[model samples]
Target chain A: MIPNNISKLIDAIINKTEAKKAIWGKTSRNEEFKLFLEKGAVTTDTWVENGIEAIDFAIYNSYGDKIDNFVAYKGDDDFDILSRLHNTAKREFFKVDETIENLFKELNDPKSVGKRQIEDDTPLPF
Target chain B: MKKTISISIIGVVGIILCIYFFEDSDKTLPNYATVIGTICSIVGLSIAYINILALKEESIIISKQIHLTLEKVNQLNSLSEISKAIKVNQEIQEFLRNEKIELARLRTLDLKYMLLHFNNDLLLNELTSDEEYKKLILDFGIDLNSLNETLINSKRKVDFTKVVKNLEELSTYLTKFELKLKSIKI
Candidate 1:
């Protein structure tokens, strides 16, 4: 079973994609944003104080540019990694939602072995 | 049968005793108690009969569910096996297509790694001694380990649907891949 947070993030992405018909439409041509996405996560700092953990993460672009940084008062849960990633993609890419939807569709596709089919298996187009 | 015979004997004896005693004795028979007992017995037997029939129906449904689940498991097993084969095939295809390595060197590296990974000793021995294998290795002039590393590091986007389709097709060919394990047998 997918964790609740991850599932919610996927749902958010799917909703966004369905709202926008195209996957990476022409309007979202932000090169800096694309580079930031490609760079992924850069650095993470974690510490526990008074039985409460605090965490911070710095994100970067491909060209060594700092795109965004986040801090979680609750440590791990604060990261909200998938949601952050989804939001970032929404800001950066035009039709990233659709791409994400398609990716999830394939990942959850019933034809794949050992994968739980979220929906009924439809015959492939071959 | 024994219960029925015993009940019949008791019933006959009871009727004879009732006739012998009640005929000579005063007062009418205790009709109220006997009527109540008969009604209670009838109600109890009806409930038991209904319960038995319900249980039999329930058991049949559970048995059918078990059979369906077993069939699903078998299909999943076949799909799992075919999925593994498809993954290996896709990885190889991707490596060969994307890597800038020489054809002979790449094939040698692929064969070596595949044999090692799968632990196919018989295939390993045959291929290692084969003239083509030796010729390719010698002609390429590349270390096997490094060549394998190059293939491993080469990255490519894999189409998930394509992989699943390939696996489905491979599963369909299980009969041809091994005679003992026919599709129908699965």
Candidate 2:
């Protein structure tokens, strides 16, 4: 059976991943978030003796830069760490949405458009 | 049978050495026959001991291989269950796309039940003791729960696009997870 804190950490990681998917539409490039759980020194073949040590959650931007990271050790409170990371993710997502909205607005504004004419010198065979 | 023969050989050699030593107490210097017998007995005991140790080591290696194979089989079993669940999820998505709410709802319920059974099976297996594997199972359950809630909330007016998107995400996640499980070298 999993410990209570470890269970909470697992749930938090799943929740964060789901939220990212909800916002970014399931693409790996868009969902640039990762949660890594540290485990004790144990062979991969022996699952029964594995132990948790820490959990780390990281968020990255489209440019592949790390924007935020949250780490929680074994003794730290899982809920507090997760909530803080969740709020940061929420804020970052809003920022991206706002940027996209502003870009669309700029593209749609008629004042930002400049008309251009193409002059073709080659004669066409009719 | 090999071990038994080795042990019997050692026991007979030990008994012969004991008899040879006890019977030659009267003579100060040992005869060539007794010396030759003792040397042969020593050689036989050494060979038998080495053979026994080699057999023990070979058995240990074979047992470990069997254990690793069993672990891989269990992981593959879980991956197949996930594959089945992915198929059902696709059918649910199709039903939703067609606006067959009743059919989709039934299928959603079916999927929820299927995942419930899968989760229980994972918990029962030793694989759940692994942190990475447990997280994968938990993530899968969370996605299924989200889909179930979305389906249940919107009864008459279903969000076709949203539900389909969720199903697609779930399918993609499951495929990646299946690959991850397959990549695990036991």
Candidate 3:
């Protein structure tokens, strides 16, 4: 089950995505990319060659670790590389979704960081 | 309309009198009076028919003119709205640009303080070596070099050029629309 804050954040993201398929153009991927964007994903344009389009994106976990991903689509025929990039970014970022969720849960917890059970010597796996 | 109807009625009466007068004229010797009357009556009839047609055409032209005027007014209104949008976009773009630059500057200052604190902490405790200090700070994800580099590379240029261009295009279109409207006869 999603936490109350998480659920509310997701709703805000979804609500802000207006006619996603229309604005971004239709793609086979689900609309999860919008959520990833809202969660602080950064995308950059890459070089295109020989009817191929490319874009790169960096997704940051709550711990500030970056996951890089790229999407390459055919430039010809109404193909939308931006939407594809979003989907790829989201998918790559999802690999560490559990860590991110745990981080958020820890942050939202009532206890301060000093009062937490974590030991000073304990290394963070982030 | 009443004047046109009255003239038409007079024209019909004139034509009837001309015909009645001409009915008695000998075919071999044409009657000058009858011919003159007939010519005058025919001219009058023609003028009355032309006048009525002109009135109808004038009404149509007036209505068409009103429509064109309304369209012109609407286009002007749209141009004003677009101008307002462009103004707002420019203000927002400027604000965002300044805000980003300020934020980046502040972040760099914060990072410098963090580094100073780290150095101060090391000085107070003389046991830790330089490499160990660097490693401990790096482990905590506070790479001063990377952070400084990022701050140097950060750009805060908010581009509202495309939006401005689009609005300008719409303005141009409205100007052209106005020109087209002016060229219309109605």
Candidate 4:
């Protein structure tokens, strides 16, 4: 049986991952996603790949060799194990999505946009 | 003093020539005297015209020098403003490192305005060409956006080592840019 603490941690990770995935699905089409990729130095494909790799690494570091046993043990359903693992990867991938979205909003604020326009329009006296 | 002396000499010479031409016993100016007076007047007028032209040329040179100096001053001013913005950004980074989220957020807003002003100053002074300016804007925007992300993530207990590294890279780039601006010769 999975220990209660480990099970709890996995649940938390899965929940966070699902939340992030939903947000990413909504935002991946926006212009800010491109900006995020540029600043974060990851293309869309690499970002997803990296996210999965990070989740795997985190799981390994946290569980060590026991992760295999946790997966193989019949105490947990095979489908449940796979679903949890998938959600964990998604959570890792979407970790910074909200942060990037907030940043884009701050930058694209109307006040800032208007200020830039005014500056561009003003003529130099010289 | 030299111009006054020359004018005085010319005036005395004119008076003497007038006297010489008019002192004929018949009290009439001779043809040769009239011709000499006309020649002298022509020569004096030509000299005056040449002097005026030289003065005009000197004024133009002075104006151009003034213009060049002003442009250099503007360049330096824009660079200093950029330096100030960089310093503020450094402070924001420090605030982030210290876990001062609210302070960093407030300062980030200030830095945004400063960056805007810096961009305008750069454009006004023509420090960077349009293409170069666009590239610079992209670079800075990326850095600032990353900084913003770091600030936001800090609230959620996210590891910020990567953001800090990116900020350091930006700081290095900005320092190099500052040096490049300083090296520009008018």
Top lDDT hit: 2
In the predicted model 2, the residue pairs found to clash are none
Give the per-residue lDDT digits (tens) of candidate 4, residues A1-126: 455665675565456556653232211111121112111221111112222321111121110111222322223343354345544454454565567888899888866543435577689899
lDDT of candidate 1 over A26-90, digit per residue (tens): 11111112111222323333444456544434444322233455556553564555335335544
Query: What is the total number of backbone clashes in candidate 4?
Result: 1
Q: Can you tell me which runs of candidate 4 are displaced by over 4 Å?
A: A1-32, A35-126, B1-27, B30-37, B117-162
Instruction: State candidate 4's TM-score.
Output: 0.44
Task: Estimate, for each residue in B1-186, the C-alpha lDDT of model 2 and write its tens digit.
Answer: 565566557767765666567655544445545655676677667777777888899999999999888888887787887788799889988887787767776776666565555546642344434454444433333333334434554321324675577567657766765776777777
Clashing pairs in 1: A24-A95
Residues forming the 10-long window of minimal summed lDDT in candidate 2 chain B? B137-146
Q: In model 3, which residue pairs have backbone atoms overlapping below 3 Å?
A: none
Q: How is the predicted docking of candidate 3 categorized under the CAPRI scheme?
A: incorrect
Interface Cα RMSD, each model: 18.9, 16.9, 13.5, 17.5
Write model 4 residue lDDT over B9-37, tens digit each, in one string: 77667756766766466455575566557
How close is every model to the real structure, measured as TM-score?
0.26, 0.40, 0.27, 0.44
Tell how far residue A74 is off in model 1, in angstroms.
Answer: 56
**Ranked candidates (TM-score, high to low):** 4, 2, 3, 1
TM-score of the first chain alone, every candidate: 0.27, 0.27, 0.27, 0.30
Q: Is the docking of candidate 1 incorrect, acceptable, medium or high quality?
A: incorrect
Strongest candidate by TM-score: 4
lDDT score for residue A7 of model 2: 55
Q: How would the docking of model 4 be graded?
A: incorrect
